[model samples]
Target: MKRVIARCLIMVVTLLLISGCNTIRGAGEDIERGGEAIQRSAGG
Candidate 1:
């Protein structure tokens, strides 16, 4: 029983970490696009 609980807890934590990484990656892409737009507008 303890082993089962530990396995479940580890799985949940791994999923959360993966989701967090994806979220951060998406945010970085958005920021990059915004920066590109600003550069284009400024003719830089």
Candidate 2:
């Protein structure tokens, strides 16, 4: 039915968004760490 298809589509989209958020958070943490390393090397 149309309702069933719509529900499935919503669920898939929700899962994709949740996964994307985690990916972005992980990338941010990595960049922060790299910046910290540079600061330490510079004695700042």
Candidate 3:
């Protein structure tokens, strides 16, 4: 489960990096939103 989550996060980060965040703060927010989505999907 941990590995799966880690992989998902890595994929999200990679995709976001490729997508162009424009700034570190924007990237962080994007990542946080992505994480929240993941948590919600996981029923957290």
- TM for every model, in the order presented, reads 0.50, 0.50, 0.54
lDDT of 3 at 35: 100
Tell me the tens digit of each residue's lDDT in model 3 across 1-44.
99999999999999878678888898899899999999999999
Best by lDDT: 3
Better of 2 and 3 by lDDT: 3
Computed on alpha carbons, the lDDT of every model, listed in order, comes to 0.87, 0.87, 0.92
Candidate 2: pairs in clash: none
Candidate 2 residue runs with Cα over 4 Å from true position: 1-22
Native-referenced Cα lDDT, model 3: 0.92
Better of 1 and 3 by lDDT: 3
* Alpha-carbon lDDT of model 2: 0.87
* Candidate 2 C-alpha lDDT tens digits along 1-44: 99999999999999986775588778688779889999999999
Residue 29 in candidate 2, Cα distance off native in Å: 0.2
